[model samples]
Target: MSHSTLKASVIISIYQDVEALHAILYALSRQIEQRFEVIIAEDCECKAVREYLAQHTFPFAINHLTQEDKGFRKTKAVNRAVAAAKTEYLMFLDGDCLPHSQYVAEHLNQRENNRVCTGRRVHLGPTMSRWFRKKPSLIKLIENRLVYTLLGLPLVFDHTKNYEIGFRSTTLHKRQAKKYLTIVGCNWSVSRADMLKINGYNEDLPGVGGEDDDLGWRFNGKGIHEKSVKFVIPVYHLHHVERRADVSTNLQIIKQNTAQKRYYCKNGVDKYLSETHEKLKSNA
Candidate 1:
């Protein structure tokens, strides 16, 4: 599609992190290319989030789609957002993650017909996160990175497995498919049609884990591949407490799905689509 015609819907998954969500939205508002819409895929109905959405006037189209407060229903929330999306392409982001100015533009540039573009994030330390919350600026974040490097803060400067921005990064990443083991749900984009073909996220796996992996595996099973846009589409992940309550169970579900080579998810976007259709018919 041409630049003028290419559009994308960024589905941001959130629970109750209002501050982080605002910060993310601020970052998105400053994107270099603004041919995208924002869909807040809220896992629960938060008054704070709703209030913020009501109060703010964003540069691009914004919609808040929420589900009732359930236990870690990010998969369901995202599937709902997918059903509501109107664009040809979809990008997923977490409320706690902030994207670079060129994030959307890079993702759109890298998009392919049947492939998913995956990116990684730099995890901010507690000190860095606090400072960022106070003054959220991408330019400041870049300055902080330099300061963290000089101060030797391993939490901030550790690039052990992290990808750095360079011309050869994308070329090298494509050659090493095996290296693309994990799909960070926070920074990934796939064509809307391809997502429907694989039936979106697997809601069978409960809680916050392995769902992204299952989607990737299913896409591969359906001959859809992944393109690593790691360094190019940079995102900053705000620090927060880790949740591992349902890690084991989610992993087992992912294993089963992979072993079975399941391409279509039973409990996914279809339910919302049918509901939407019914609502339209009722109104008609």
Candidate 2:
């Protein structure tokens, strides 16, 4: 599809979780809005991921982009995806997060210039995760979200947290003050131009907990506001063991960058611009 025709480029950051990745793809397939393409930005070029994509049939066009398996370089992987986006708007999703059927529709509907839309996810516990692992179906989850999440709440193994977001009620979509909302990388959409204004995700951060936050803060610095679509664009997060990265190092860097109001990050999509220029020059 042409840039103007595509609603958004859904860029998903993933690594080695083929099961969860497939679940995410299936969820995207069921989105009410299907005028977008999927970009699988894997941190590592895994064989299983390639094999699965090779075998699977998806409704929307899907492209797989991967980097060498370097440790915890999600920011880099996502940035690469951003560089390759074929649309004007960009939606980000983690491999383990499944967007609601209306997720893409709402996100595309909620788009505004100089504003970033961020949404929250319902954490699926082991029970639902296992249920999904057995057979991942976005439609089934949507159909039984209330009951399944409610049932999971009683048992400790079914550690479903903040599941209220999973419930799709017009009353519960309490959008925060536009300027103060937090950006959840897994479920956020921003104009590609707005993102590139700040040079996209800060690759220098080197880990989670800071890169997305820093991206939002930088957007704020550039006068772009954060608009929360919390309940309106719900995503169901599949369970997985957390990967811990060194926080102190990334934290210190974030503090310095924030204090400096460095909206255009040093290590980000700017590198791609340089690389592309060099390639074009060589071809010329």
Candidate 3:
């Protein structure tokens, strides 16, 4: 199908965040009008999630895929789901996120001719429940989403700053520019053609470190500049406890790849997926 005619595909990578997964799925079910497919990539081979997915029916088709226990790292699992996405436009989010009602609709409405559109995210505290308090109109939700990070920080119901601190900046509210670089994987989308040009997510990324940064840098290198999706497409980040250890080692790989163009692209993801597929198949 042509890029314009293609449906949007949302890819979410989860590892043991069952509570967050529940909220994410629930929010997606209540979305206003939109055309999209949801892919839930469970990084670990857990029966609880598979069982939950099997029992709950979503408004849209949900494809649930599991990988053999790959520790807690997220890069590999994310790429696994991306490989299976059929839509030309792809959005990536963590399982702990609650998208506003217009999340999907606004994303579809703001396509800038193959440009990668990134949205503004609010950090919701664990104390605050993100469940359905009331049904929201599409326009109101979109307007809220457009609010920039710094401006929305004070008003966020959650009051937790963990996720917000990393993103709050007046610069984020502006349009695309030469040195612009802010890539939060949680609410980012790009055309399929653009992803293929960058060879998709780097599977060899040892850990979480530079995967998001690499994608943003590569996109900029290819002349597809990044732009903040105005606060109109606001999403609530489901609260969660801190994660152990830092995944910065992968950031080094990102730097290495940047200096040497098409490193992961040259290696290709087919072998990595084939190996992962065989590993999971053997476990089965």
Candidate 4:
């Protein structure tokens, strides 16, 4: 797919949540900065999601990619999306999480040549999740963040944690100089040129839980360590059930990788890179 000149790409990893994806897209369209494209990296090719995407349009370009639904292969799914990304700079967001209005702008502002930027999220509980499911007005949530944060503090929304991360301000937007920053896949950004050097996500990872930590580990080995943007960029995570089926395997793989000091894994985005992509890398 040909792309226009874009400042960055927002690659969203999703399953069969077209409704939540709609709200996500709505939030992306209203970002304070508007120079990025979106890529939907779906783990399965569900017909409903395809139909919904075909019917809707956003201000920025949108592309969707899907693989056969075998099981929890988020590594394979997102690696493919990263290989398909048009810009050198990009971010990863879960389908259920909504980015703050200044999310992209702040990320762009703080991007360093050889470092990845990672931040935290505000996890919403059942009550607020139900309210947003009925009417997902992300703008309303941001505008009245104090009211919502107070409600969440009292447990009125069940277990909506991380209220401190919800607030955004230029005063607090400074990146931490920490050398080893643990990551959450839902709110992170890295350069395509740098990520390809360590090979994207380790496709050898079996499940969802520890890929971020694994990636951060490898990034440090490759001299592309992480910088903290904790109190800087905020994302609201809609509630969802926990998925821990094959998470044990991920932890095992991470342990093995760290023990062996494996910076570049045998399986990753390299397998999915096309000839055009190779030339793109070579030219870089």
TM agreement with the true structure for every prediction = 0.87, 0.91, 0.77, 0.90
Model 3 residue runs over 4 Å out of place are 1-6, 129-158, 162-181, 244-246, 267-284
**Each candidate: what lDDT?**
0.79, 0.82, 0.66, 0.83
Q: Which has the better lDDT: candidate 3, or candidate 4?
A: 4
Candidate 3, backbone clash total: 10
Tens-digit lDDT track of model 4 for 127-171: 776677667774465546576556654544378778767777555
Q: How are the candidates ranked when ordered by TM-score, highest leading?
A: 2, 4, 1, 3
Q: lDDT of model 3 at residue 245?
A: 41
lDDT of 4 at 241: 88
Ranking according to lDDT, highest score first: 4, 2, 1, 3
Model 1 clash pairs are: none
lDDT score, residue 131, model 3?
Answer: 33
Error of 1 at 77 (Å): 0.1
Question: What does candidate 2's lDDT look like per residue over 198-217, in tens digits?
Answer: 99988888666777778878
Best by TM-score: 2
Record all residue pairs in model 3 with backbone atoms less than 3 Å apart, i.e. clashing.
142-232, 145-231, 145-232, 145-233, 145-234, 146-230, 146-231, 146-232, 146-233, 147-231
- What lDDT score is found at residue 86 in candidate 2? 78
User: How badly does each model clash, as a count of residue pairs?
Assistant: 0, 0, 10, 0
Question: 211, model 4: CA deviation in Å?
Answer: 1.0
**C-alpha lDDT of residue 10 in model 2:** 96
Q: What is the Cα-based lDDT of residue 41 in candidate 3?
A: 81
On a 0 to 100 scale, what is the lDDT of residue 24 in model 4?
83
